[model samples]
Target: MVSDRSKGEVSNVEPTVCWVVALKSEAKPIISYFELDHQSGNNIFPIYRNDKLGHSLIISGVGQINAAAATTYLASESGAPPWAAWINLGIAGSMDGEIGKLYQGVKVINPTKEKVFFPGYRFSKIVSLAEIQTLDYPTPVKKNGVLHDMEASGFIDFATRFSCNELVFSFKVVSDNSEQDMKLIDKMVVNSLIGNRLQQLDALLDKIITLSKREKQRLQIPDEVEEVFKQFHFSVTMKNQLIQRLRKWKIQFPNRSISDLVKEAKTAADVIRNIDDALTDLKFDWT
Candidate 1:
């Protein structure tokens, strides 16, 4: 994939990873209020540069809808190579912890009040996980999830459509407690607290991205080709048959070559297409 920064120039062979921020006001602390790039580019991902912290990232505007939209747009508009994963990074209110600490989200509860599990992948030896609930409105209330944020739901829903579960991650830096007024937490204060942690976050991102890229490469083999068959618009019966056949082959030969899988799948597609064509011809009857 080409980096938008260089127009069509293929910059990095490495899969691009998006670090999405929320609304302009929410993003001010990480990147400047005006510098958020909704546009596509290589250097386009929003980030804040502090002398202490190497770089911090941000997404779009706020709310679940805005968060989802921004995340969807980012996933679609690739300035960097198609990202391996979409990372939702921002500040959050924590009920159980002290301010300024960072935590990885392990579970996401929807605004409908249903608890949805969307957890981040484990990176290296570091254990970064938290259960979070997405609320319609900002709440100072603390719950079992540990932290409260505005954008992970949008990021998770959008990214999952394009990539696997391993490709989505949410890192929330605690800005204030549920009891504290969100209005009072300013950029300087955020910088003061999270500035040092950006490096850690970046390192973690690098690790996760590496793993995601590797996994994507591996799935490009037979499994993904089979997935395409199952997901593609085909007759339900044909899809089920194909899935069953593929499952049997996979079960028998745990490690099958992608070439064999592709051949088999292509043959199935050819048969299906031929059958459809024959049906159409039969439908023509005698003119």
Candidate 2:
């Protein structure tokens, strides 16, 4: 059944992670698992979102172009934060014997163009690793012991441009082996395969979310610091240094206002000196 076309509730908060998957069957597990709701106007391309889970998912139909376009749409429509993780999760044909096993994509290759993508810098302990080859159509041929899929290459190629390499990841569940017929697979079977691995997949999602949050905290520049920069006229280099020092200050004194430390300074030079003195006084030792 098509979703109700009425507008969903407006959220002041936005999701910090984006999930891209091909086919409605591939997306169903995530939508149910995450409790996502459809955003009304996005009927053109099915987009489901759950801000509380920090996830936004887009159904990209079943092609490389559709995958790429859907990912781009999720980023734009959901206001995907720069620090958010972009993941491509779907079913793939694998030569490996494990039909329900999940594997992290270490590398993605486009067989036709010879283009390659090395996505996600961090390694996962939860799932095994495998290479992926994206072809124009579903193929039983698993080149070089890697999984074969129809959309990962396009998704990864576009996703890497928007998010850092470390935050981009792909995980494929092996739905068919060389002996299994692709035509036999159905929604119930696909859903069951993903449903069986919920525990493991949830764990992987937790790790990815944790990493993304850490990156956000590190890269965020405090609004207070920005206000000061505007008033005092910090140079480009000085502004960068100020932001770094502000981050350290925040870590050391979580509740203290960094603005107070520089309030007494009459000039930009004094601001730097005061912060430097505070840095010298900080004790890094902890029990």
Candidate 3:
């Protein structure tokens, strides 16, 4: 079922999609995941083929450095044949927006230091693009302005190397404000909304794919090198946890390939596995 709207040169590009979530449990909140064959199919939002759309999601936990590091590693490792775009999708706090409304971030500004960052997306209105801003702590009061979050800025720098202007997109759903009772909205509620957010996400992907087609020629797919960190080995438990985190990063930056990330996992694992050795190594460095 090809969508009549799926008009574009079937360039040999499989857009790798990444979803970024704040919490580990919040990743891929959607219950039943479906793959569309073409944009013309029965499902809503001009369905497109799953194969043509390479997708991955990430849960970088909380904070800016973690988000940036995860993103940098993910981008460096995306082993997709022709990596397409990188997307950061998750919940955010908006000052002037209502709950459940999705905003294509036009400006990513840090309220703490007044640092401004822009998304790679092309927007008509003067809006902030999605950016990761370092907040001192969870915003307790709803100040004024657009969305607020922990990690969009970190992913932007690494993602830029892969695709051009249209290759990056930031989609955020308003979850809490300074006025809302955030305690009531626990893990269960956030998880439930993730399921609902997928629908809107599909719509966003549709629009993004169309844009990618228009600027396909000017796009420059990044050729990333894999540097396996052999410093340490990880135990089974630690390995699983790291993989879980890696999976979230992949989801956030779908364009990232498993091949690129496995090395980091190995390195991280080695460090965890040889804790004493790692400590000794650190001691040696200090000594």
**Considering every candidate listed, which one attains the maximal lDDT?**
2
Q: Per-residue alpha-carbon lDDT of model 1 for 1-287, expressed as tens digits? A: 11132223222433355567774444553454213233335343343322121222445667777777766665454432333666777778877666766778877778674648665675635635777666677877767447777667767877677667766787777787755677888767766655546556656755775676576545443455455565345566877655555544544455754344444444557644533443343333243
What 10-residue stretch in candidate 1 is worst by lDDT? Answer: 1-10
Query: What TM-score goes with each of the models?
Result: 0.60, 0.82, 0.58
TM-score of 2: 0.82
| Candidate 3: segments with Cα more than 4 A from true spot | 1-15, 30-52, 80-83, 111-114, 122-136, 219-287
Which pairs of residues clash in candidate 2, taking residues 3 or more apart in a chain or in different chains? none
Question: What C-alpha lDDT values do all the predictions have?
Answer: 0.58, 0.80, 0.53
Count clashing residue pairs per candidate.
Answer: 14, 0, 45
lDDT per residue (tens digit) for residues 58-108 in model 2: 999897899899989888888887788998998889876478888888898
lDDT of 3 by residue, 37-153 (tens): 333432211222344435444456676666666655544444432236677666677666667666676666666657665765654343334334436466655556667777666
Best-fitting candidate, scored by TM-score: 2
Cα displacement (angstroms), candidate 1, residue 32, comes to 9.4
> Distance (Å) between predicted and true CA of 89, model 3?
1.3
Runs of candidate 1 with Cα error greater than 4 angstroms are 1-15, 24-58, 79-83, 113-115, 178-180, 219-287
